[model samples]
Target: MSTAGSPSTVDAPRTAAGSAGSDAPAPPPAPRRRTGGVLWTELRRGVGPWCGGVVVVVCWVAMYSKTPQWQGRWTETTDMLRSVALLLCGPLAVAAGCWQGGRERRRSTGDLLASLARTPLRRALLAVAPAALWPPAGYLVAAAGCTLATWPYAGEGRPFLSHTAADAMALAALGVLGFVAGRLIHWRLTAPLLAAVTYVGLGIPAYSESPARWLSPAYQHTYFWDRPVWWFGPASMVWTAGLAGVALLGLAARRRVVALLPLTVACAAAVVLTHTGDGLWRPDPATARLVCDDGTPQVCVTAVDRKLLPSVSAALSGVNARLRGVPGAPDRWIDGPRTPSPGREQLEAAPGAIVRRVGEPVLLGPREAQLPSPFGLAERGRVSDPVLYANWAVSYLFSRNCPGSGVDTPAARRAAAVNDAVNQWLAPRPYAVPAPLPGDEVHLRRLHGMGPAESRAYLARYLAADLCRPDEVPVP
Candidate 1:
């Protein structure tokens, strides 16, 4: 039945074999695809480089712009970085996650992708990996930048990597939750709504007075002398991971009841970890211990303020010399109290110790100007002008300046008059002479008339009197 050019059956087989052998070596069997290559390609195509870039940029800007305030300590630097991550990066992660989750729906590829052999949960994990990983990676990059920036200025402390790690985990969990939300809802506004809700949720705990505020990750600011417990970071990670797990299960798993187990266990562990009286952090001995100077009438500062030890020591030396033989004279100068307070420096007195906080101004000033003495009458818990002025006079001998006790009572006026007269007698400068109050004339006259010897005797008497008992403080 074949034509002459078509040839017979034996010739047809030979021709087919020749054609098959000649067809580009069968295209090399299509190069055998690998799982890693596919996953990587999916990650690159889905998230895009800009997503990670934006995260890194935001984190860098947030941390670097505020570098001046947080550069003094590793704890402060890391704390600020964590705060920025919560406030800024957390929301960004949510939006990015939502965007990533909606990719299939946006491209109308959901049905096509569903037809693939991979299970839904596995596919979801692969898709969610980029969102979950990039945010934490961005946080770590920012943390590392902050750590490096703080290294030159930071003192006496190591970076708390556990805190940063917990923060990274929390952010990743939030991203996963957002991805799940996007998968379930398929709304365009979900990203912004989730962001708003997250910000509000974080803000509520920060502003609230209840102990339950501890549930918020943003509430974990490190106290000045304290460090978080070892378990606290892990507890936060587990709790957040549980939340993310529950959300993932809701989106990807077939059984909802079984999914709650991880959340329940996580909540229980979080409760147990945070239930201790120490709260999230405890005083760190290394950062809180007294760092003393080498000299008589020992000068000591908390380890965090070791840089100020020299100035504090020099300031206390003159006062200590003046009070060498006096009763009730402080034998030690300590930096503030054992507790932490924000922005306020208090000077306190114990039996033989005088504790005064070294503020920023003092730390930045010259050695001679950093006088943090405990000689003000208010410092001794006395409110009377005469007692205050007498204490001021003793302090003036060491400080060469008015105490400016900020008391405006009649007694204070009289004390000021006496102080001016004494200052005039001692220095004879062209300064404004304060007019003596009616009863203050005698004290002023006596103070103005004292010679060096009489002044020494007067100072001894003033120093010996009990300023705490205002009635017993003798007025010269």
Candidate 2:
């Protein structure tokens, strides 16, 4: 009792511990006690997460590098994402799925898994889940990242959610098909080889003109201003999902006849898409509708170009100054298709003629002049020198659609020189004044000699004169 740490005391404590352990119910088996069970084990330890990480990295890097090309337009942004999903994401998913499918065999666990009481289809489903599902999850994350980047600056339209869903479905199909391929092929390089082959397969149809090209998920789109038909996205989903379902059934079903249902569904979807073709797109009324600026000689642009209205109005200030209240001048400067719409009067000042189609084919109706489409003039939100375009517009108004307009004749040539001189005075080019044409220097000096008011008066007389008829043209 005096020696408190004796062997007898230690043995007493050990005996009590053993008695407590024996009295308590034994701990449940490790499998029963596991947090997420065996499926979690497969997902946690597999390479699937790495594949998803790879997808996000590739998408982010590609998208970041070309931000200017797609950032300000919802259609452009969605298109860019779709392209990446088809070209890069599809291949990556295939490769990752293949690797995952072959992992059990690689680890010599194929025999153990085969001997398990679970059916082959159930075992395969558990194995394929990480491969088939992870890629789509990764794609959604990537799409969200792109959307966040685009929302602040995107103009005039909503995100193409259907297109995004179609692309994700395509990626899942690719992953499932890849897993099937891997389960069948035992070669170590099968995953990478399948990826390369799949890339070529997806690409070949993109450049094709055949309607069958629509069957491929990689098909290109047109017109940032155009919207896809409402059912196009859902139909695309059915097409891709049916294909993936068929693949999965083929790999795991004891009765492969079950695959025919998905196969038939996929065939029907393919047919519908092939027949639909470009009919899938329609002009978006919101984008195609005209938005006008409050300015003298009122500037009008399509709603898609609403943001550019201020800059455009500012750019045209000099031209408006010259043309305002001038006889035969345009009343409304409108931007869109070159061909005039029905019931709309187009003031086409061809040198010898001023063709106007008012309600009664006369000049009395409000004059609507066709302005060049601003789409080509601006790039990545940076507008080019507007003065250059203004110069062209003025010169176009001056040019005569003579029978020999295309040919360079002496009289036509002289008339062109005079026309060029007048254009120069109206809208000065920002840079590189070309060496003067015949009589160009003289005309320029004469115009420069007059006061602004006198010059403006002279310009009016010059425009009213038919430069196509040399006798009708006024001397500067």
Candidate 3:
């Protein structure tokens, strides 16, 4: 006999008689298969993620390959690689997390899996398993693919070496953030929104005038290159840790809805609590401290090693002399070339004068640096350091034989005219040529104006200088 709806004796399995039983407890039902291996199985099912990884890698290869910078020394190419990685890979990781999380939730598998005997921690990890492994795998594949693509084109040091060690670590952190996001948000709508918000928050301010803006992920100074700011190391760790914590907490709450509300509230509260009323992050005083060369320049004009020191010195000297020749030159001083060790190469100068490499100039100075804006005439040419500007000035002085010769020919003039028209349409601030034509060589030499050496140097260093300004900083 059995209670209503319960299995009756006839339907139930009959126990063996006492003699067959031998007091052995019925095998305990195989202990209900452990859920530990779920993480492994889930991770194995990340083929879509792998394919996505492949797509990202392909894009990086294609894009970076097309950049003019990729054609030169392995060193520059590697920096570009790292910059592209930092700029692109982070968002991709977040996207991976969102996709995997949404799929699991949409399938209703998360609820089913969570109902199993597995501990919540194991369950959370299992749910995030795909994101955890795949994004990093994607980053690794992207990085490796870039290195491989660049290998045949490399002239010196392994192209991979040109990429900084920090990139790998940053990518790993990106992956973890993605994985954590997957575990926390199960809804399709919320997952992507959350990821986007996080990404925007991390990147928006690195370009801000405030030094604390360095807290922004985009502020990872010297993106592909190197910049030494010990402050960023700890800040990055803290931020990553905080994000990881929030992600885990969101996963472990009693209910998903309840878990989510707090994150929004916390973010709101932080905004209120930290608000300075100003539109920018607070500047750190240390930011003003000029990192000096003191014989060991990390990124300044004097940063060049002894082997290349002579060349760098010669370039600086030439620039100073040329500028002095200007009728009303600003006061000039060639501070010993100094820079932070392990920084993107640049020529530092006092505020009024732009200091840059002759062969390669840095583009970090204010707009005033490009004084007399030579518009609708020569396009931005091989202008790097002040020395290079001198070189360019001299070169331009020589390029023309007379007012209508060389680049002054009818075709050249027509091209310039067309370019000037196009520039009018594209420029945020349209400008007209100051003179009907660029000055002749004689005029340029006499005026100490923009020269040929400057053009050549600009051509060589153009990419580096252009890339130096933190993204979205609007070339200052």
Question: Per-residue CA lDDT of candidate 3, range 111-185, in tens?
Answer: 786677767765666666566556546655666665675555332233433123445445545555665666456
lDDT of 2 by residue, 1-476 (tens): 54765557658889889989889888776654342476787776687888788888888889887776677678778888888888988999999889988888899999998997778888888888778777888888999999998876555788999999999889888988888888999999999999999899999987888878878887767476688899898899999999988988898898999999999999899889989887787767787677898788888877766666776787788989878887767787776433333223565543344332221111223466655555445544434668877876665555444444566666666766777678788787777677678888688778778887887778778877766566566767
Worst 10 residues of 1 by lDDT: 375-384
The residue pairs that clash in candidate 2, if any, are 351-400
lDDT-superior candidate, 2 or 3? 2
Best by lDDT: 2
Model 1 over residues 1-476: C-alpha lDDT tens digits?
88877679878788888888887465556676676887787667666355667777887887666654566666677778878898887888888788888888999999998998878887888888888888888778778877776666455678888888989998898889888888878789999999988888876877775656777777756565777778887887888888888888778876778788988977886686556524567667788687887665566666755654554455445545654544444455554333343333543433322222322222211111122322221111222233233333233332321233454766555545554444443333333334444555576678667775676677667555443333434566
Give the TM-scores of the predictions, in the order they appear. 0.68, 0.74, 0.47
**Following a full C-alpha superposition, what root-mean-square deviation does model 2 have from the true structure?**
6.7
- Winner of 1 and 3 under lDDT: 1
Candidate 1 stretches greater than 4 Å from native? 1-28, 45-48, 295-298, 307-332, 340-408, 412-476
lDDT of 2 at 134: 79
RMSD in order of candidates: 9.5, 6.7, 15.0
lDDT of 1 at 375: 23
- Model 3 steric clash total: 24
Candidate 3 regions off by >4 Å?
Answer: 1-37, 55-59, 66-83, 144-187, 191-199, 223-238, 253-476
Higher-scoring candidate on lDDT, 1 or 2: 2
- Residue 432, candidate 3: how far off, in angstroms? 16
